[model samples]
Target: MLAEVQADELVSVDDLIPDQAAEFVSQLSTVEPLPPDDDEMIEDETSENLVEDDSDRSRPVRENGSIYFGECRLLNWTTTAKGGMKADLAILDCPADAVHPFKGLLCGKQNGQRLRVWFGELADTDVPMQVNYQGEALLLRWSDDSVNGMNTQVMLDDGPDGVKGTHPFTGLPIGRVEGHRMKMAVWAINDDESVIDPRKVKRKVPFYQKPETTQAHLLSRRPRFISYVKRHERRLTRGQEIRADITIAPDEYIAEALYAILGITSRSELGDENAVGREARRRWSSLVGEYFDDFYGRR
Candidate 1:
């Protein structure tokens, strides 16, 4: 095609452009138009999906509101886990509300009902968000007298397990959960002020014991008390034993202390065929038991 402006001045080419001419432009290089940004993609396009599938890494988790079913000790944090303060309300009949929240992570059922979770500073490793409760479930409501200094109901995974807790009375290092036994938990208080079942109640946590002014349960078992006294004496002879705050030491009038604490005026009194000897034996045994409790704190 010829330029219209240049054709008008051309005398020789005027007849060649007799009819018409179409204008055309020549390319400087072979550059294509850039594709739309929406259509553009990286050389190595992504193949993985944004959402992930459940893998072995994923674990069962629990939370504050999680419910459970099992037989675990009801600890009272209201007074702190200083000693094993068991729950006076023994929930022997807990709910059989065993649930399998996750694979192989079932909370076993107990007697009466499933326990509602109330976590207080307990953590789970497998699932960070989900909660794995401190311990077991199931609750039976056996109401007793109202506890002293009773606090809120909840769960506590951290405790006197291993060498984690300190001794309440002696202020020494506690080696283990020495006096732990499973008991009932207080669930929810009935609005009507009526006694409710533990599983129905809705709380978690402990109880206490007395020995000084009150008689210890241990005294009821004469054989066990005698055995305990003997064992305690042996531990005293053992230089590096866990005898907490006992005054008498190894090879230091241990026998005398025993006799004095028991009030055994003579060894023959132990073999007393006479009623007088029997009375002395009884006196000494009782004294020795009291002494043991004095040093070892009531469980």
Candidate 2:
């Protein structure tokens, strides 16, 4: 179940995002994150921290009169990923009214360095461009380089699971998309079979409810949180560990920070379904209990 948030507690829907993000996202209608500053750049492992002030990364960006659901903490931004793989954590917040946009950030380890990305700039991975709207049965395409791309072309109506509506490749509805906010489960695909396989390590992502909130509120909000678990594993070993991260929309710093803690801790405690599930539930319960009195005492 989800906790109830008072409207008073939320920034007026209009002010959900700050001015900078608003202006930046607006330009996505025709622009894209200038390619990687340098091809030799590498991802930073320590750049994972949330924006403490309502500065650049924390402010929300507006689009189509709705809050843009893209923002995150910079996790890594290296001149070169080198032989090892780089992981990132980001939180997306596509409101019911806003176009569900996909974006991410790469960070530099010093804790302050980072790079931002709009879904349009992520074409490298072939992130699904067009998804059949579940309710409308319309295929939306990424037309230009802007946030929603450019033009939204409805290719086809809703159909089978893989073809349209909601499916894996089309990460739309892939995360928790409900009410005023949504959350995403992020992963970094690596070359190592052991790392990518669910049997070795699996993780879920978490998100904040409103545009602006404290770390306590960020930690307390559970509905938008992603829960991860290892589906297959035995005799967990430290060397086989994997890196998993988290992200929050409207800010890159926070996502990186959440990723480091959750990733390192969760990876160290890898376990089978029963054990992992139990731990996840416990962590969730404890978190929810601390903030929501209504959720704490109940099953």
Which has the greatest TM-score?
1
lDDT of 2 by residue, 1-299 (tens): 00122444434422433332334334323221122222222221111223222122332332221222333322221122232222232233434344323222222233211112222211222232221111111111222243432222122212331123222123222222221212212121222211111111111112332121232234423333322112111112223442333343323332332323233233223222566545544444444344344324443
- The TM-scores, one per candidate, come to 0.18, 0.17
- For candidate 2, what is the total of clashing residue pairs? 45
Stretches of candidate 1 above 4 Å error?
A: 1-114, 117-149, 156-224, 228-289, 293-299
Model 1: per-residue Cα lDDT over 1-299, one tens digit each: 11222533423311221111101001111112322323211121111101111222222121111222222333322225442322221222232342212111111222233332221211232323222122322233333223422112222223322112322212212221331223121222222322222222222111012221112222322344434555566443333333333334432343343444444544555555678556555655465555556547853
In candidate 2, stretches whose alpha carbon ends up further than 4 angstroms from where it belongs are 1-99, 102-267, 288-299
Candidate 2 lDDT score at position 210: 19
Q: Please, what's the RMSD in Å of model 2?
A: 23.2
